[model samples]
Target: MNINSIKIATVTAGYVAGVWVLCSIAVVIAPDTLRYISGAMMHLDLSQWDWEMGMDTFVVGLLAWSFFSWVTVWCIVTLYQYSLRSFS
Candidate 1:
């Protein structure tokens, strides 16, 4: 089967936005948890971790993620189309 790249990109962008919203909410609610996780993952001191969240940050992240996701998905779709032709 074939797929529409634009539609897929829209869906991918929306998924990224949704994930960013959830992550922002999580950070807002339990910033300390995020700080601890970050510190553990990076082997850094929790005191050095700054878990900050705001509307401006969320909007900027959402926009960036949406654009990045759309472009990434578009590239994937293009590669898939190319591969299909190679196989045919």
Candidate 2:
């Protein structure tokens, strides 16, 4: 089966953006809980990690992460397509 790389990338990016917004909301609502969860997941102390939830920082991070996710997924799909052709 062939996959539409652009469509998949767009969808993945949108999903990531949605998740980012939700996480931002969570950070605003329960920062300490989020920090603890993150620390536990990474097995590192994030108590000293300062979180700057400025508007500018949030906007920039959202854009940068979405774009990064789009590019990464697009590349992966393209490579998968190439591998399928090579194997066939």
TM-score of each: 0.85, 0.95
Overall lDDT per candidate, in order of appearance: 0.88, 0.95
Question: Per-residue lDDT of 1-88 in model 1, one digit per residue for the tens?
Answer: 7888889999999999999888888888888887788788999888765755777888998999999999999999989988998999
Error of 1 at 57 (Å): 1.2
Question: How many backbone clashes are present in model 2?
Answer: 0
Candidate 1 colliding pairs? none
lDDT for 74 in candidate 2 is: 100
TM-score of 1: 0.85
Off by over 4 Å in 2: none
Specify the highest-lDDT model's number.
Answer: 2
lDDT of 2 by residue, 1-88 (tens): 9999999999999999999999999998999999999899999999999778889988998999899999999999999999999999
